[model samples]
Target: MKTIAVLGLGKIGSLAAVLLRQAGLQVTGFDQAAKALHDIPVLSDDISSPEVLKCLCADHDAVLSCLPYHLNAMVAAAAHQAGIHYFDLTEDVSTTGFIRELSARGNSLMAPQCGLAPGFVGIVGASLVAGFDECRSLRMRVGALPQNPTGLMGYAFNWSPEGVVNEYLNDCEVIEDGERKLVSAMEWLETLYIDGVKLEAFTTSGGLGTMCETYHGRIANLDYKSMRYPGHVQLMNFFFHELLMRERRDIAGEILTNAKPPVDQDVVYVHVAAEGLVSGALRRSEFVRTYRPIEIGGKPRTAIAWTTSASVVAVIEMVRNGSLPQNGFLKQEDIPLDRFLETDTGRLFN
Candidate 1:
């Protein structure tokens, strides 16, 4: 069995630990909070120090981080020194670039952005561009939303508040006219109509992954953004930038998390569209997916869990089976979409 060490026993980490154990991997879970993993049997150690984490990861085949972006560099460094493959769900651009640099000196794979948008969305977009000639443009959008809204914001706490704040405050990377550029956050506001629902989306950081850099000089236009209900973006802009809550983000995050009720019922929206020439004719292809709450392990798992956990699981299988290239930085687009969606674990996304 392939032993895996999952760092951080937060929300995503707990779900991943359970799923990985079910997949027959000897899972060792580490987290600061002892109460978080009381129900799980793998909480035998605490990864409090970098040296301790390095030793723990040395005995495992891989190390998966579900910690915040601030901890990714340390985790990746430890994994590099231990010669174990590393994976994370961070959307931070600079952190990812640093990991890319770390990958050059290691004998292990360092794959970041292994979550919904940066992970699965990138794979789907790459699949659309496959076997196509004269590619025109590609647009990708994803969202984790509450199934029913009762609050004024029309949403619930489905994911990390810090992550949402980062998306709004950071400069989003996009491709325009085949050139990579940085656009101000909360600027490219646009309304989108999906499934008869009038939703809104705008510029957000880290959603584009390495697509902008990868597709530069190839595709004319490529962009990724977060999907929200109408009026959400304007309200956030007012609070984050206008009201200068960006200066006091921790308080803002606390306010939002405290006010926003957590909901068990949720939905994940996925839409990837590509326009190009096929067989000497102009054509466009799209993949639209919607996933709802499902019961797993006799308990309900949110759509985000289903999507995000499925992503890392797919990559883990790829690396374990030699299907994915090892010993370097691996981008999400490097994985084939069809092969991903066809995997036993990836079927959760389907």
Candidate 2:
């Protein structure tokens, strides 16, 4: 069996290691915190140290990074130098660009943005676009929210606070009128209804992954948004824009993280829509799903943790079985949605 090393034994990483081990692969974990991985054999190594990071990744066939977005570059470089494949769940565009550059010079695969929005949502969006003869417009939306919200924002810290703040503050990339453009986050707000629950969506960064470049001139309009409960965007806009929190994202992240506690009972929502001409008539296709917390390895995991971790693990399985290209930068859209859901790990979304 192939051996894999999972870095960052935090919320998503711990579950990812569990899934990898349950798949019968030899799995080793590493974390900066000593107590992050108590149930499994792990090394409490400092990821900031180049020599130590390289040594930890050198023996593995592939390394999955669940560390914070800012730390991905160091880990990715180490994995590349160690001649091992690298995968990460980062939604940071700048980090992904760096990994893409590393992949150009490395012998092993380097895949970033392997989590929910840029990951499975991109796969679903691409599939919907493929159904059209002439694609006109496409929109992808995803959200991880508390099932029973108690806060003023009606949200919780389901994932990394740094990631959340970064996406909200960064400029978003989209395709408009057959040309790629950069738009402000939290703009273009719209209301959406899912399963009779009212929610809102707005432009978000990095969720589109490489889709804009892939479908730039081919489609007239394309965008990705983050969905949230009603009134969430207004409060966020007031805090980030009116209060100038956008300029101080680090402080903003701290305030939000401290205010909104992470919840165990969370849900993940995904929706994708494509409109274009099929044959001679205009047609629209959509994919939608709501994911709840589920039991994995005899333990109940939050929906966000399971969905995010499952996506990266499924992609790793695909790489191991030679289904995906193994020697270059990999995009979420490269994996077909049907094929992804068929995998043991991807089934968690079903």
RMSD of each: 1.7, 1.3
Query: What does the lDDT come to for candidate 1?
Result: 0.83
Model 1: per-residue Cα lDDT at residue 211: 89
Tell me the spans in candidate 1 whose CA falls farther than 4 Å from its real position.
35-40, 44-46
Candidate 1 per-residue lDDT over residues 221-339, each given as its tens digit: 99998888888888888888888999997788778888885688888888788999998999999988888987766778888887888788887877777789888989888899877
Model 1 lDDT, residue 48, Cα = 57
Superposed Cα deviation of residue 296, candidate 1 (Å): 1.6
* Residue 300 in model 2: lDDT: 89
Per-prediction TM-score: 0.95, 0.97
**Candidate with the greatest TM-score versus the true structure:** 2
Q: Residue 286 in model 2: shift from native, Å?
A: 0.8
Clash numbers, per candidate: 0, 0
The lDDT for every candidate, in the order shown, is: 0.83, 0.89
